[model samples]
Target: MSLDIGDALRSGIDDLTGEDGLLVGSVFLLYSLGSLVADESLSAELLTLVFESGAYTAEQRAMVDSFGGSPFALGVGLPAAVVLVVLVALAGELVRYWAIRSFAGPAETETDAFGDRAVMAVGLGGAVALTTLLFQSVLPVVGQLGGVATTLVGSIVGPLAGLVLLTVFVYLRQEIALNDGGYGETVRNSFARFMDDPASIVILLVVLGLFGLVGGLPSLVAGLAGGDAAVAGLPVTVLTRLLSTVLGAVFQTLGIAVVTDAYLQVRTSARESAA
Candidate 1:
């Protein structure tokens, strides 16, 4: 009943190159671009408002003011920017439902279950967002306690907590897509799956993490460079960001494929053993 990592990876690669995979990749690309625009615009406006209000520390204010204006603007206020970001996120979630079902290999007769699956996807997304928010909300309180031990603990625990949440999320997606389970059942099943084969999950996560790091290099370099150079009168930073966005889309799509394949392998093994 153990996972065959090599077979799963090969199957995943096949899934990623399929026609539906291209659709998933395209949706991810649009989502990435939309999020970048909305997030940058919102961040600039928030910083400007904070700076003008002098609510931040003097040092923080000075650094932000040095930008000479907003780092990015879309002529939209914070409220509008928030709405745009939410819309983009919702769109992505809807498309992701289809992608997940496609990966799960539903029968043609099950096409009518789209509404149910879509609702489950949205519910799952909301639950994850709330969980993440709650987790992050604890960090400031820990920081305010103000001790080196607390800081060290937070640094170590934070990444581990994030990784656990991510693992749960990945398996939960597959469970919801492939099984007729509600939120609670899916959550429990995902946890059980992790407990049953933690090593396989860890290996899959490490592989994905390496791929993500490679995909993110362009963006990291551009950020470190501070975007000082221009090529053909276009900023190198812009070009790098564009390249990073594309790579991110590809990486995300591949991750989804690989995880889905791995989940199916585990599920099939369990079923055969039961039989």
Candidate 2:
């Protein structure tokens, strides 16, 4: 009982354009802020590292030293970074919410399961943040220590592992969004559903990977373009960042809908097979 990947993608697109635009819009705004802040923090860290590496003379070092300790740059933008994490979490949550509504039918009342959804959002967001932190901090150190083989293995394994984990998350999130379920119920249902029809996991990963690849082009172009011409480059980079964020939101919503649709179809197929 194979899932209808094409139909799921079509439904996903329709959901984003029709019913889920506002949710996707909010996701874009939140994701853009997070991306911008994360970039700024990374730039500050790089500048500091360059200064500390003694690549420059004392005067030159002094010039670059300013990059190390601005209010926003210092401690990696502190409260703003914290806020960005929350925003990222929200972005993750809204996509799932939109998907659940589209697939399972919208909530009958505005107040329906808001609290539970918040819990699910926080959980998903925490997982997202943790995954990122490990990729940023742990992976590099491990790569350096393990050399080329380790780096190569990680490059292959990391994304595959992340994809698997993400599907699990999606499974749980679907229950949280669609069912009036507790954490326990969500966990059980997600695991049960996936175990019953494992192929949908692949479907989800492929769909998300394709969409993410397409969505990431703007950021790639932005980073590649924009030479030292600060006047030309700044606006171009800024616009591209904005565009990337918007694309990100679009795909996030689309991914959720696609996965949910896959899940629903898979569930039906599995049930029919059992019958």
Candidate 3:
């Protein structure tokens, strides 16, 4: 498959320009909200509650507390995290949509919502679930290896897990397209070609890495500033989590968009090759 970096970037821009901003915004809002609950800042409280309520033993709580994240993140912090995520997603989508549109034309209005959501759920959800599972299984070994060793293992394992997840995601997405009156086998075939063409996969990963970098910079900067400071109460903890969620949701969307577009591009390319 031929690589066209310029085209991809331009297409992502066009896709965003053509999107129903209101719809996208609404989705972002919901995503941001959900993310708030998922973030570490807010989740700590929930986890604490669970631990305090006897859901887990004191030893488990100790392990969790030992991880040493921001304790100041509570209620407000959580919302900030949510907004951060939403904003990042907004930025990522702005570029991604344009890039996609440059190549694919306007996304189909009739199928847009369902198609997007389906891809998001399957692609993102699958990756997260798989990664979490793998991470959990590896934790024992990681702990035995110590912090440095665990971190090293995580560095290698995370990307490998992503590759596996993407492969599974492509297959499922193709099935959706084919049977759901969606995009059809185009995605499936393209994914196969991308897999065969290592360069294309490398380019895709590079693009995704760029996206991650863009999405991560703000939070990293915040953490550096004062985000790491500890808060005194549950309310603050909840806020912090909310903020983390919003930020996570936004960045997560970027990831979701990249996966979706790549799958679609692969499908399109495969069809052209077949033709």
Q: Compare the candidates by lDDT and give the number of the best one.
A: 1
Candidate 1 lDDT, 1-275, residue by residue in tens? 47877877777778778888887888889888886777667656655554555446798566544433333358598789757756665666666667777766765213457787777767786566445533443342243244567656655666567657877666776776667766788788777777667788788878888988887787667655555655687666677777877998888788888887777777766667789
Q: Which stretches of candidate 3 lie over 4 Å from their true place?
A: 41-160, 167-193, 227-261
TM-score against truth, every candidate: 0.79, 0.69, 0.53
User: How much lDDT does each candidate structure score?
Assistant: 0.68, 0.59, 0.46
Predicted structure with the largest TM-score when compared to the true one = 1
Enumerate residue pairs that collide in model 1: none
Candidate achieving higher TM-score, 1 or 2: 1
* Stretches of candidate 1 exceeding 4 Å from the true structure: 45-75, 107-112, 133-160
User: Going through the candidates in order, what is the number of backbone clashes in each?
Assistant: 0, 0, 57
Q: Which tens-of-lDDT digit does each residue in 110-174 have in candidate 3?
A: 23443443554354334444455345433332333345575566657755665566544433432
Q: TM-score for model 1?
A: 0.79
C-alpha-based local distance difference test score of model 3: 0.46
Residue 28's lDDT within candidate 1 is: 83
Ranking by lDDT: 1, 2, 3
Residue range 23-74, candidate 2, lDDT tens digits: 6556556655665566455545544554555545798555443222222333
**Model 2 misses residue 198 by how many Å?**
3.0
lDDT head-to-head 1 vs 3, winner: 1
